[model samples]
Target chain A: MSEFDEGTAVVRRPDEAVDSSVFDTELDKGWQIGGGINGGLLLSLAARSIGEHFAAARGLHPYPVSVSGYYVSASRPGPAELRVETVRAARSHSTGQASLLQADDEGRTLERLRVLAHFGDLARADEDVRTSATPPKLPPVEQCVGTEHAPPEFLASANMLERIDLRLDPAYVGWALGKPSGEGRIQGWFRLADGREPDPLSLLFALDALPPVTFDLGLFGWTPTVELTAHIRALPAPGWLRITHSTRNLAGGYLEEDCEIWDSRDRLVAQSRQLAVVPR
Target chain B: MSEFDEGTAVVRRPDEAVDSSVFDTELDKGWQIGGGINGGLLLSLAARSIGEHFAAARGLHPYPVSVSGYYVSASRPGPAELRVETVRAARSHSTGQASLLQADDEGRTLERLRVLAHFGDLARADEDVRTSATPPKLPPVEQCVGTEHAPPEFLASANMLERIDLRLDPAYVGWALGKPSGEGRIQGWFRLADGREPDPLSLLFALDALPPVTFDLGLFGWTPTVELTAHIRALPAPGWLRITHSTRNLAGGYLEEDCEIWDSRDRLVAQSRQLAVVPR
Candidate 1:
């Protein structure tokens, strides 16, 4: 199995309460982007737990239609607990909240991340309507620059690069070469290195997998994501997914990054927006 | 005080529990869009409750930096209760959850909307960094078409038109005139009809004040928002706010609308994205 599959896998535990369920997972090494596990991976764990919780209970809504998550604190590699609370399980859709927690040095349960997601059946969803939507234009994976071209120091901590194959459009990565582009845009292709097909759950990771768009504008340092929201538009077919990230406003020490992802079939599969602070 | 000030105003009550505070507000008439109250106005109530909760408890963070909300059920003009829970209180920032509830016919509290928001002091935010960001070019409000031209039928249920002054870019509203633009873009200027100055709280309404972008695609019917997320970039500088709403992806019975709001000074004040289902 791919390292990502193992890393994000969660083991369901007995119910903590009538409306809440608990899941345990190890925050394995090699996913660190800075000093903490990748925000996308943490989100995926939450999504997985929610998916499992609903599958076992209702078996009606299996796909996550929309999810919003807030990063409370940095989580390190260790055993973590994700407590899933069933907020509302309606006939059409279900809404749930998942809080990823870990023990601090003092043995206090620290909240790492909290997420609220809505689940529905995509197969029962309306088909693509005729509209102006189109896949992002990008050079094929072979023509795009791989992480091997990233600064060695950056690649050192971005161990996620080892698990997920990411390729960037040459135009948006001038900062990596010591010359910043100032465009505040990044385009790339992503896929699990071991070839595990992308699914709705993993699309959460893919939506946030790209290097912070600020990197293209020449900013460095950790820009912790304050809040990230993702909408899964459709299920993905196999193969690489094209992604484009752009930032139009950076003010008040905060920046918003918008990402659009399209599957190999040229279908717009997912969209995400994240609020992150610009490094001071 | 303007209707907006009164409409969004929340009166804080004693704590419902230790970590939870309750606020009461009348949904008020003149804000119904389709069959329920405007989503933006409902979100404003949630933001207001969070603001008041933190101010009374810790006076540390007064502005909502980011907020994500799920519309559980439709709410009408009536008395509603917003329960605010302190999620985490940190030195730098705070997170809170607010659930807007209204009693059903059976007297059970029905969850109408729930939101998670991050609060921080915007005054301490970093100065605007140099980047490729600018406001949308819009004709002066006077030259744009106002709600007077909307089909009388739409303007009937859209009493929100009476409360919010919305001026649309003519090119994007052909559908209103029965031409159907098919561009899926809507640009306009927004301000309260009573001339209430815009603030961080009102910006939440401004971010979602315009007609759904799907209207430009010639589709009609209530497109319920499954999820909406907004980021308050900077406090507004009063006057009319230039707003642009666009949708590039509409598939699987759902559409994603992206909105960007700029203050009268052309400063991007807030941005939002919402996922809504296209009418069947």
Candidate 2:
């Protein structure tokens, strides 16, 4: 498999002039295809980009904060424009959204997301914490991914899921991956690696692709994301992204979803959820 | 406190020339307020109403399969108007979005949610059955709702919340009532009074109003929501809405978020998460 170029890791703004040469018909399917970023990957990157914009607007460091959720509606691909809008910026937290539109080879605004972001706001008085359960533990990551038990390798290959290693937590054992890096309910470590250093925003781009395994409960085995969301608990580490998520299957073929993130130290990082369509 | 007249759990829809009295008086605020129900609450009811409509359209039980995250932009409150359009509907799942609008009796569009919904398809898969972990033991209901550990009576007095009770899982053994739901992680039980028939939509309405108890890891506190989302996993059986969530602190005060939901049988019910404004 071709490796992600080491140089592509630098934060590239959507508004920046991108070479149409990077656009490949073959990439219409590549994770970083159109304009060199696949829809899913682009969705994640767009979210991180929005977060970064929010931070830069406020002159906050550690760069962009995090993502709440991301959606990618489609038209034909190419010349798509992603516009970031800062919704609200608070002391402990901030909020922003991005609209990624697919214009026909030229620029026509086909589909978009008002992508959203959030961060820790320290403005209020610390209230009593309601989260108290230790993150459920899980088996080794080796048991799930890279194993015979996993679905077709093509599934993993298609996801191009970067920097995440999941293991079912032995406790609730509910899709627990590993630990995050904060001081709240969530506890996991995360970082993006395309052979470059990952900023807080880049790490999140990688985090938003995985679905809560618990949603698998209703799986006769079809998974399609009608919508996707992420709640970053804390800024992640620099090499790998680890987390645990559980999904609740509703009566019909639909799923209302939720996923929580923890920093590596078992500190509360970010929590998130979404509603999705079960591909029939 | 007066009880919600459980007479007919139906909304006075516009088609029937229903009473528009409650929605009068447009209030300019981040939230749209109706005399009887808030925007969040109305959205839930509307989903149910539309869900049934889809079911009737397809000759099904009008099963609500899922909901895209709830998006609430700023709006003026007055006699509100909602318009719903089906995105795609199939025998398995029906999906659609609705727009909620309000004008000062002048037919101006206040806010729109292209709210998407999915219904009728539910999956039951093994391989991921992690329900072995029982809901942790916690104190009885009375103690939790009446203590200083919770927001004092008035702030907590919203009538819609009266029928629900939440408690900290003793396994985590938290003090100060407990930590609020974190960014992508949340935990707790919620349900209507025992014996009340369970309505997937009603549970959903509650889910929408759910407040993420995210605390500031940097300052340790709670933040307001710019947006909230809910996902349904399984059909609930008139039980408590067990929930868990966490947060990610970001630059310029922004973040990404996620959350999960469950029923009394400890069955995975649904999940939700959102990007919210965590104020400093």
Best by TM-score: 1
Per-residue lDDT for B267 in model 1? 82
> Model 1 reaches what TM-score against the true structure?
0.97
Indicate the residue-level lDDT of A171 in model 2: 36
User: How accurately is candidate 1 docked according to DockQ?
Assistant: 0.72
lDDT of 2 by residue, B161-181 (tens): 444454544332232344432
Q: Once model 2 is optimally superposed onto the true structure by TM-score, how far is the C-alpha of residue B273 displaced, in angstroms?
A: 3.9
lDDT of 2 by residue, A1-280 (tens): 1133321122434344221111111123335321234333554546545545654566542334334333334323234555665544445444455555555555544444445454443323244343444553534444433311234432444434443343333333232233221111222333333444433444444444443343234232434455655544444444444555444343344444445455455544544445544444
For model 1 chain B, the run of ten residues with the poorest summed lDDT: B147-156
In terms of docking quality, model 2 is incorrect
Off by over 4 Å in 2: A1-28, A32-40, A45-193, A208-222, A235-240, A243-280, B1-43, B49-61, B68-78, B87-91, B99-116, B121-133, B136-196, B208-223, B238-266, B274-280
Q: How many Å off is the CA of A258 in candidate 2?
A: 6.7
* lDDT score for candidate 1 against the true structure: 0.87
